[model samples]
Target: MRAFHVTFEPFSGGCGCGRRGAAVRGADGRTDALRLRAAATAHVACQVTKPNGSTHTRMGIKKLIIFLLVLSLCLEGGSAKEKGTKKGKKKGKQVYCPSQLSSEDLARVPANSTSNILNRLLISYDPRIRPNFKGIPVEDRVNIFINSFGSIQETTMDYRVNIFLRQRWNDPRLKLPQDFKSDSLTVDPKMFKCLWKPDLFFANEKSANFHDVTQENILLFIFRNGDVLISMRLSITLSCPLDLTLFPMDTQRCKMQLESFGYTTDDLQFMWQTGDPVQMDAIALPQFDIRQEDIDYGNCTKYYEGTGYYTCVEVIFTLRRQVGFYMMGVYAPTLLIVVLSWLSFWINPDASAARVPLV
Candidate 1:
């Protein structure tokens, strides 16, 4: 069945009808606004869903960053603690000065090490002051040679060795003098001791009574700490008793035997009164000056038998300290004299009367 359609005709500018139309238009506009509002609501729901998804990811990243920060702090704290602990512990290595070494400590060094110490401590021998046996006069040449040879060859004589302790009272705080005198160091016998071996006699074919006058076969030791020790052995051949003979003749028999035969000890002892000791610094043998005189037996005998030999052995052990002084006393003056002579040549010959005289 077809329903009857109601159709409204437009009235001409009438108030009631126009107002109804206006209201209808207004209603349509309101419907459009509602649709727009629905669309905006849907967009807002999609935006909220996306933001929720991203919120979890952002929160997880923040937690990871915080954890890393805490872990770094813990590791840093542990490293700092380890460093502090290390610094608190003591180190194992140590250093020592020469003065720090006590007597006991010095004793621990081997003999070879002690020798090295002495080599470093002592001064070397001077070449200029070396004894010139050849320069001796012709008259004294034979005696000098005999004395030298006897000193080197003889094994025994008045064998005496001494060890002296030298100590100076200078202020340690003050600088040492330019010309420091070693003699200024006092000799303290109580600080050192010595050992000696005596000479013995025997008979030989060349000599009626032979005796050793010098301890040539002896070995002397001077430690770096100034201790001295000596070892000596002697032998001689003599038909007669050496004790009965006169001064020079008695020494000849001893000299011949000492030059010919001897035995020596390999080791020696050096002790100190200070009770504390170090190694030997230097060693030197004593020197001897010997003189000989020919004696005539009253009988007219042409042979050497009737012509007895008189020999004298003068042993002088100018201690090592004294030897150094002797060298200095001789060489220092000579060097000064040479320097003065050279300077004199540089002086103007016309400058002064002294210059002319010197020239």
Candidate 2:
């Protein structure tokens, strides 16, 4: 859904022009850029253009260009700035809001999801979370270049993963009319009360920095059958563990795990949106080939005080490091250098450079 935003900036008093009471200023705060430009345009049109009749046309063209450039730049910068702020402010407490339901009706609702209405987290759109494998930027085949052989080639990837948590459990208070007998109605999740949210986090994150694509419940689709579905998208960057002990000829297995925080296995369950419960996407690296994709699911049970078993899903990506890249960049160069060093051996035995053996 598209959002419409409109803000009005008031302009007050003029310019360096001798015209009295012709200046403009912001009513509340410092002057706005557009307002200042507008004031300047007005000053030019009123003071300068009035004297020279032919100059009005030229000045008008200049004023229009200035206005266009200023408006375009301001809009673009403002949008980018607003998006950055939104993505940054994602860490915070959650406040649940529900549709208007009476106190008596609320008392009738159950505290948790029953067996009949088990909520499922559906991948509404194709998820794009942490595309690389084994701490390598391998999402795109083009990024899998043999730049410096042994040196790690870096590439950036931004993933947008959207998931929907939907469950059907309706209320009589929010019933619809005959004409509005549609299966669902969409509303802001914050406005809808008594919704259950899973405790989700990226478990194998090695970096402190990440970009949150969005920070809102976004949308809540409530169906007539009492099904409540919440859809939201989140973005995060991760560097998987890489051994590199074998260098280019080595195989790597990286993991991305997701587990329930407070809720134990008894309270909640997690599964893949499709195929195997531990399903994952294939790596996009060209030089590094993927051997196999694996999934591990188990309960983390602790015998400590007030601890319970929690279920977790660990997605494993097995990658085989391409040797050709390393051979060209590292091994080949070293071999060449070593062969060239042999030339020093051909020098006179008396020379100090011949003392060292390149082989």
Candidate 3:
């Protein structure tokens, strides 16, 4: 069977004078077309009563549907763009900030400033390797400050000392900006773990400890000329043999020594600071008075059985024993006892019991 689709236009006048209705023709062409057209035209007339506002209402409905469709398309486009941005962020690497500064300090730095100089120097840096890999020796200047001196024991032949050790060296790889204004820069102590350091140890120390009461007692300073400094506090028990042949009036000599544990003289060398290498606070001990101290910076290349020659440095301390303690506690009491015994002889020929007790 064949079927026809028809469309009708609204009537112009009350009698439906001027209008066009669509129709399809079949084997019974004229009859079928006339029936479909009449049916559609009658249906349109019943739906709209007044001809004056009918056209305007139909146009308004069409505009509303178009506006809703456009709004929905725009919303979908925005959602797709947001998803693409999030995926790009997940695929890219995050930037690294300097660990030496806290977040609050980093906020104070200007975006374009050279305050974060470490970022440029440490891009490809390796902390496990030494600075100079071209077979050149790195010269380090060493200094010390004796905060206290005590625990001098004669029986155990050892003494305890607390000190601050500072070492300075230069690495050409750490370049500074041309417009840098500061003479030196101070960084966080934790940065010490991220940089290369010389392997140094005390030669004559029996035991040692690094200070860490509230936090790690360490310091780092960088100069404009590529020099780096590291300072730390340490307590050490060192061998200090004493001579007691002179007993109460004896003077004792002690020394502290430092040497490289891994690097030999060919790769590293240590020298004392030129003018004033050693400094100390006012120190006092119970049994001895400090006479003098000596700092030796001469070359100390010594050969080991397995390893090559290593570098070393030494500091010597001279202490004189205080004799007044012995006099008051030992000599004075003995003299009084002998004089009292002599008096007992003069008074006790008849008092045998009292003389025996005194003797």
Candidate 4:
């Protein structure tokens, strides 16, 4: 009896019969042509037994069909699973554009306490209108603290001073939350533009500058009762007329007057704080001394011909000149020269050089 061997290779064409492929090799020394009925995708080898020269080609083809069917199902299931995973990821990353959202949608978004309160207060607020409008006048209280004082120049007839200018007024429009615990809330300086502020200007200003080092030197505090307070540092040069006829003994008066630029007395009025409206920090000068008693303030409201009377407040500073510098540099030197000319009379008719020089 002779034994026959069988080996299967991957099909090169589409599934089923009628596809051309390499003929299967057998171990019988005979090159008989055989048409395989197996699917084109099957890739396995099997042995066929020929008992008493009988063939088992039908049994071999059946096994190959079952093996290829199982492999094709598994490949299709894995591809579907991957497609499902990609779809889930795309749905999770979905985001809505802000421009497509409506006002009701924006209201649904959550915000912290401070941001919500600010949005409510500023939503309908107009900075152009005064607090009371045509009703009662808005009383703006002013306070000034002198940080440092510069020289009282006789040549320019002006003086420079650095000060912190503080102003307070009530709005009654910034409603606070009921659960708010603090008496006041200090806000960022950038918020200054969103609120109505007094149109205060210096009436006696020759030149002025608002400090801006290390961010703007502006502070704002909003009180629970809608009382707004703003303070800023300023370097100001004010005109001061001097009576130099008194020379080093002159006492000059310098004034800083605050007045409204737009709103008149009917809409806004200026007032000084009750106690300690003006403060000093031991300000020293080279040629003058600023006494605390000489610092005074009063209402300087006056009327104009066409324009009505506007609100005004003035702070007066009296500077007394020191004579120590002049006595040593001017009067003392003059006295020595006159005394030396008298010595010319005592020393000589004989010393011509000394006498002529002294004369």
Candidate 5:
């Protein structure tokens, strides 16, 4: 028998001839190539299909993962944006409206302790009573400039206020009794008196704008008899210094300082009725004596008076305005007599002689 052809062919799924082959044994102990080739072809086809399928699956999974990551980032960003918008609205609301303090709240503040030094108090005429004069006349308004100097001494603060008055005048309403009049009016300085109400008393921190200072309540009063007085009641809250004993020990110095404030009203014009119309008169300053006192410094229940603590300065200043007289002598009558004599000299001599003879 012809030797059983035993041949094995190297499988090339592509059609080709002269391909290298390998020998295989048949089931009947003979070489069989067909079955072997068929099996190899099937294995190659399965391997190719498996790899392609696995590649497609992996790419799909990757795309799904990237999409999920992008969506999660977008959600987080949107949440942060919403939170920021809420915060902005809250700040905007607070900017337009602010809380206010009630009148009862202001009443809770304590009064200054310096209210009692001089017992004789002179108050200004109530503005309500003088409704016509509710606003100060521009000519009568006094411009005062006050400068304060202070030093810290043992247990007290030594402070002084320098005062200067400009264009000072007495109220035109002051009148003298008929019995007090003299041929030459001798206006005594001691007979006049005055009092000034400081502007600090009516300050309300809540209603007042933080930067405003023009809303101060201040007044000046004068007596017919030359005496000047000042009354100031101020309530102030302060933070105590670290060293309390460095305050000044002398109370008199403090009083002097409080009285040192001065004013400028020189340009002020005084008005008087001249028979028919108002006329402007130059106002003269009065000479007066000044006395100062610091009555109470709040409550001594906690500490000694004039200590380095939050307290007020109640000051009383007694002052006087002096008045002098202007003498109008017989000059006007003398001039008239001289004028008549000159006219008589100019008269015709004959006419004058005839008139004299008839008399």
Candidate 6:
């Protein structure tokens, strides 16, 4: 399809009466090379580059090839744009953070309500208040320093104990977004600003380990169900009334009572986690042997003081002095002395050394 000027008198060998003009046509017999090249270059910008960095077009044949490539490109571009729009719309939907709470669950919210608070409160005793001790430590601080003089065996007999108190309740206000497991928030006492806490107090508290601030704390557990559990660790000292009639051979049942400090029975109430009023901790005292004797909960009336009645949970600690130390220190020595005293019969009670021991 190269461009060539048509020559006149081209049919000399033929029997032509007059000179005929030869018309140059492309292989397609439709368009000339120059016109085809112009159309291809105008419609398709792609060029066939040679090693010499020059562009070459293959006359009429290249025009159809470039046109088909350009048409495919245009169709693909439209399809890609349509697909992108649909994907963007699909991704635009919002995901929820907090799962919503039901209305029935919301009505059961315990904050600021007149309902009684229930908790699992269990007690344990740490017996190692001092070196080589065998009895229950009195005050964790005080019993370590107590001294024994004469037959009194003057050691404190109170319980130095840790109380594990746990309360689990739902406050719908503590809910978090369903999408968030709550990196966004936390639950603390302040979060339950409107919730009423049972005014629990130790009736016979002689000393407290944490006196300045409350030994209480609250933690938010889950946002979905609005579940929260409040846990408190309390170190308490109670002066147990001692009856030393049995001396070292006795088991004592001392009591620790928990009652609402100022709340009347109408204003506030407390209940056990289970149907039973008392729950025992599995851990036992290290030195002294203690078992739960009795647990009773009832209204302690203060009719004389006009203070009405207060709800109380009372626990009785049944314990025996771990007698190994007592056996060695008191019983063994007394037994040896009694056995040696028979030597006085061998000698004369009238002798001076014998008289001194006898006296």
Best by lDDT: 4
Across 209-315, the per-residue lDDT of candidate 2 in tens digits comes to: 32234545355665654444554433334455567677668776655556667655555555544433332344445667753333333433333357766656555
RMSD of candidates 1 onward, in order: 39.9, 15.3, 26.0, 24.6, 37.7, 28.9
Higher-lDDT candidate of 2 and 6: 6
Tell me each candidate's TM-score: 0.16, 0.44, 0.65, 0.69, 0.16, 0.44
Across 1-359, the per-residue lDDT of candidate 6 in tens digits comes to 35533322333333211132233345455554444334444333323332345555577447757675675666567668878999998855542111233445545756443220110000111211221134321111000111111111236756666555555544444444454433323444442333334456778777866422542344433335544455555567776777878867766666666667766555444444556444554534434565434334443433226777775555565666677878888889999889887776777646877567654
Sort by lDDT, best first.
4, 3, 6, 2, 1, 5
The top-ranked prediction according to TM-score is 4
lDDT of each: 0.31, 0.46, 0.73, 0.77, 0.31, 0.47
On TM-score, the stronger of 1 and 2 is 2
Higher-TM-score candidate among 3 and 5? 3
lDDT of 3 by residue, 136-249 (tens): 898888999888887588788999989999999987666566666777778777667777888888888999999987878998887877788999999999999888899899
Candidate 2: 10-residue stretch with minimal lDDT: 138-147
Model 1 segments beyond 4 Å from truth? 1-200, 203-322, 356-359
lDDT of 1 by residue, 1-359 (tens): 22222122344532222212222113323423323333333333332333324333566656655655665566667768877777765432243333334667656666455332432232232212212223421111001112122232333333222222122111122222333333122222221122112222222223332233442233444432233333333232222223423322223323221110121111111112232221222333333232233211111111134433222122122211233444566768888778877877787767787675544
326: Cα error in model 3, Å: 1.3
Model 3 alpha-carbon miss at residue 157, Å: 1.4
TM-score of model number 5: 0.16
Off by over 4 Å in 4: 1-112, 353-359
Worst 10 residues of 5 by lDDT: 113-122
lDDT of 4 by residue, 192-215 (tens): 877899999999899999998877
Native-to-model Cα distance after best TM-score fit, residue 209 in candidate 1, in Å: 10
